[model samples]
Target: MRIAIFGKQFDPAFDEYCLALFRHLSLTGAGICIYKPFYEFVSGIPSIKLNPDSVFKDHADLPECDMLFSIGGDGTFLDAVTIVRDRPIPIVGINSGRLGFLADVSKDELPSALNDIFEGHYKVRQLDLLKLDTHIPAFGELDFALNEFAVAKRDSSSMITIHANLNGDYLNSYWADGLIIATATGSTAYSLSVGGPIMHPASKNLIINPIAPHNLTVRPLVVPNDFDLTLRVESRGGSYLVSLDSRSCILEESIELKIRKADFSVSVIERNGKTFYSTLRSKLMWGADRRN
Candidate 1:
C-alpha cells in the first residue's frame, strides 16, 4: 500500500507523535511520501530519515496513493481536499489541534487507527462537496468545498445584502454580515456558530444561514441538495469576500454566484466504531448537561 502525509507547519510538542506515526507506518512496509515542507522540518529532528525521492512538494507532484493522511487540525484536512481535487484517494485526518470536528482522529488514537487501515478494518464514507460556479473563477480548479462557500461584506463596520434564488425562484434577500451555503458536512462548522442547525452528514440537504442578520426573525433555511442556487451581493464597500472552506478571495459587487453539489464526492476513512453521532456527543457535549 502507498500512503502520503500532508499538513502545514507543526507545533514542536506534537513532533513525537508525528514521528511515531511515520515510524509505525514504516514498520507496515507501505511506501510513504511526505509533503516536502514537512519533510524538511522533521528531517532536522534526531533519528528521522525521509527519502528525498519520496517527497512531494505540491499537488501536481503527489503520486497516486491508496490513502492520504492529514496530520493537523480541521483546516489542514480542508487543505488536503484541495490537494486531492476529485481524486478517489480516501483521506483520514489525524488531529493535532483544537476543536477537531472534521479531523476527528486524536493523537492518542493514531496508532490504532492506522492499524485499522493496514488490517483492512476501516470504512470509506462518501462526503458531498459544494461546487461554486462563478465567472470570476477565483479558486482556479479547486473551487469546491467540503464544508461551505460563503460571501461576506469586505468592510468590518458594514453589512451586505445578498439576493438569493433557488432554481430561478426568489428565495430571500439576506441583510447580514455574510451568507453561508453549507453542506451537511459543514453544519457543525462556521454555520453552527452563526445559529445554523446541526445536520446529519447523510442528509440530502443544504443550509443557508445568515451571519449576524440585521433582523432577528431571519432564520436559517434548509433546501434540497439538488437545487442550484444563485446569489448576487450588494455591499457598501463595492466588494465582498468569497470563501470556499479556508480559501478566500475578494469579488467585485454584483458578480452573480452559483452553487450546487459537486460532480464527485470526497471519500473519508472511518474506523473503530466512530459514528457521526458519537463524534457529535463527544465533540459538542451534546448530552453532558448536569440536569439531565
Candidate 2:
C-alpha cells in the first residue's frame, strides 16, 4: 500500500519518533511520498528523500496516494487538507504536539497506531466543509475554506458592523470584531475560543459565532445546515480580513460573502479507540474539575 506524508513543520524535539515512524513504515513495506513543504522542513533526516514536484502553496503539484499521513500538530493537519482539498484520499493526523484535537496519535503511540492501520484497523469518516463562495465564478482564486471562512475587523479599536441575513431574511447586524462561521469539525477550534459551543463532527449544524460582540444579547447562534448566511462587513478599522485556515484575503465593505455547505466533503482516517468526546475531555480538560 502507499501513503503520502504532509506536514507544515517537524519539531526537532520529536525527531526520534519521526525517524522511527518512517523506519517502521519502511519495515512494514509501505511506499511513501512526501509533501514538498514537509520535505523542506525535515530534510536530511535519513528518511526516504521523495521528490516533490509540487509544494503546498502551488496546490496543483500535490501527489496522490492511498492515504496521506500528516505529521505534527493539529495545525499541520488542517494545512494538509488545503493540499488534499476535494480529494478522496483519507488524511490521518499523527500528533506531535500538546493537546492535539485533530492530530490524534501521540509520538509514543506511533508503533501501535501503524500496527492497527496496517491490520485494517481504521475507519474512514466523511467531514462536511463550509464553502464560501464569492459567486463571481471568474475569481476562482479565492473560494473554498475546508474548516471555516471568517471576516473580522483588523484592529481592536472599533467594533465592525457586520450585517447578517439568513436565507434572504434580515437576522441582525452584528457590531463586533467579526464573526466565525465554523463547520462541525471547527466548532472546537477558533470558534470555541470565542465562546462557540462544541459540536460533534456529524452534527448538521453551522455555528454563527460573534467575536467580541458589543451587545450582550448577541450570543452565538446555531443555525440549520440549510441556512444560507449572507455577511456584509463595514469595518472602520480596516478592510475586513477573511481567513480560510491560514490563508487570508482582504475584502472591501462593498463585497458580500455568502456561506453554505459545500458540494463536497473531506475524508478523514479515524480509528475506533479514539472518540471525539474523549478527545475533547482529554484535550480541553472538560469536566476535569476535582473536588478536594
Candidate 3:
C-alpha cells in the first residue's frame, strides 16, 4: 500500500506524528511519502530516517499512494484539495487543530488508525464538489470547489451587486455585502453563517445565500443541483474575491463566475461508525437548545 501526507509542517505535534505515522507504516510495508512542506520547515532538525517509507519534495517523487493523510485541521484538508483535484485519491484527515469539521481522525487514534487501514477495516465515501466557469475578462473555466464559491467585497464600506440567472433564466438581483453559491458539502461553511440552511452532504441541492442583503424579504434559496446557474458580481474596487473552496483569487469587475457540480470528487476515507449526525452532535453541539 502507498500513502501520501499533506499539511503545514512547522508545528511540533504534526512533526511528531509524521515520524510516528511513517514508523507505523514502516512495519506494515506500506510505502509512504511525506509532502515537501514537512522538510522545508523541519530542515536542519535532527534528520528522521524513513526506510521503505520516505520523504518527497513533490507529489511526483513518491510512488502513487492509496491514501492521502491530511495532518492538520479542516483548513489543511481544504489545502489538500488543490493537490489532488479531480484525481480519484482518497483522503484521511487527522485533526491537529480546533473546529475540525472536515478532519475526522483525532490525535489519540494515530498508529491504530493506520493499523485499521492495513486490515481493510475502513470505508470509502463519495463527496460532492462545485465547479466554476467564467468568460469574464482575465478569467477561465475548469475551476472547482469542494466546499463553496463565494463573491465577497474587497473593501469595508461598500456593497456588491450580484446578478444571478438560474437554469438560463433571470433571477432577482442580490444587492448585499456579497453572495454565496454553496454545494451541499458547503452548507455548513460560510454559507451557514450568512443564513443558509445546513444540508446533508449527499442532498441534490445548491444553496444561494445572501451576505447581509439590503432587503429582509430576500431569503436564502435552494435549487436543484443540476440547474445551470450563472452569477456575476459588479463592484468597483482594487479586487473582488473569488474563492474555490479553500483557494481564493481577486478579480476585476468585468469577470463573472458560473457554478455547477464538478465532474469528480474528493474520495474521503471514513471509519465504519462515523456519521454526519455524530459530527454535528459532538463538534457543533447541534440542537443544543437552551430553552428546551
Candidate 4:
C-alpha cells in the first residue's frame, strides 16, 4: 500500500512516539510520500532516519496514494484536507497532543490502529464540506471547508451586522460579532463555542450560528444542508474577515457571499470499534456524572 504523510511541528516530548510511528511504517513496506517541510522537521531528530519514496510540497506535487496520514493536531488534519482535496484518499489522523475530534487516535491506540489499517480492518467515512462563492478569485480553488464558513468583523471594535438570506428569501439580520455557517462536522468547532447545537455527523444539516448576537432571542438555527445561504455584511470598518476552516482573508462589505454544500466530501478512516459516539463520550466527557 501507498501512504502519504502530512504533519506540522510538534513538541519535543512526542519525539519518541514519532520515531516509533516511522519505524513501524518502514517495517510495513508501504511506499511513503511525505510533506517536504514535515520531512525536514522529522529529519532534524537524531534518533529518526526517514527515506521516503517521494516528498510533496503541496497538492500539485502530492502523488496518488491509497491513504494519507495526518500526524499532528486537528488543525493539521484540516490542512491535510487541502492537500487531498477532491481526492478519494482516506485520511488517518494521529493525535500528537490532546484528543481531537479529527485526530482522535491517541498514542496508546497507535499500535492497534496501525495494525487495523495495514490489515484492512478500518471503515472509511465521508465528511461533507461547505463551498463559498464570492464571484471573485478570493480563495481560489481552495474555497471549500470541511468544517465551516465564518464571517467576522475586522479592524473594528464595534460589532457587525450580517444580513442573511435563504434561497433568495430574507432570513434575518444578525447584529453580532460574526456569523458562522457550519456543517454537521463543524458543529463541535467554532459554532459550538457560540452555543450552536451539535448535530450528528450523519445528519444532513447545516448550522446558522451567530457570534454574540445583540438580541437575546436570536438563537442558533439548524437548517437542511440542501438550502443555499447568502450573506452580506455591514461592518464599521468597511471590511470583514471571511474564514473557511482555519484559512481566513479580509473582504470588503460590498462582496456578496454565497455558501452551499460542496459536491465532494473528504474521506476519514475510522478504526473498528471506534465510533463517533464513543469519541464524544470520551473526549467531551458526556454523561460523566458521579451520581450516574
Scored by lDDT, the top model is 4
Q: Locate the minimum summed-lDDT window of 10 residues in model 1.
A: 44-53
Ranking by lDDT: 4, 1, 2, 3
Using lDDT as the yardstick, the better of models 1 and 2 is: 1
| Alpha carbon deviation, residue 279, candidate 4 (Å) | 0.6
What lDDT tens digits, residue by residue, belong to model 2 across residues 163-213? 999999999999888898988888888998998898899899888999989
Scanning candidate 3 in windows of ten residues, the lowest lDDT window is: 134-143
True lDDT of residue 284, candidate 1: 87
Can you tell me which runs of candidate 3 are displaced by over 4 Å? 13-16, 42-48, 51-63, 136-142, 287-292
For model 1, the stretches where C-alpha displacement exceeds 4 angstroms are: 289-292
> What TM-score goes with each of the models?
0.95, 0.91, 0.88, 0.97
Residue-level error in angstroms, candidate 2, position 253 = 0.3
Which number leads on TM-score?
4
TM-score for candidate 1, please give it: 0.95
Model 1 Cα lDDT, one tens digit per residue, 1-292 = 8998888777887888887887887788889888888777778877666663388887798898999999889999999988887889999998987668778998887888877888988889999999999887788988899999999888779899999999999989999999999999999999999989999998999999999999999999999998999999998888999999999999998688999999999999988588999999888888998898
lDDT of 1 at 205: 96
User: For each predicted model, how many residue pairs clash, with residues at least 3 apart or on different chains?
Assistant: 0, 0, 0, 0
User: What's the ranking of the predictions by TM-score, best on top?
Assistant: 4, 1, 2, 3
RMSD of each: 1.6, 2.7, 2.9, 1.2
lDDT for each residue of candidate 3 in 1-292, tens digit (9 for 90 to 100): 8888777754564667667766677777777677776645545346456443567654346447788888788888887776766677889988876677788777777777777777888888888788888765323333777778888998888888889999889998998888888888789889888779999888988898999998999999999888878877788674588877766778877776778888887898877667888878867887789975
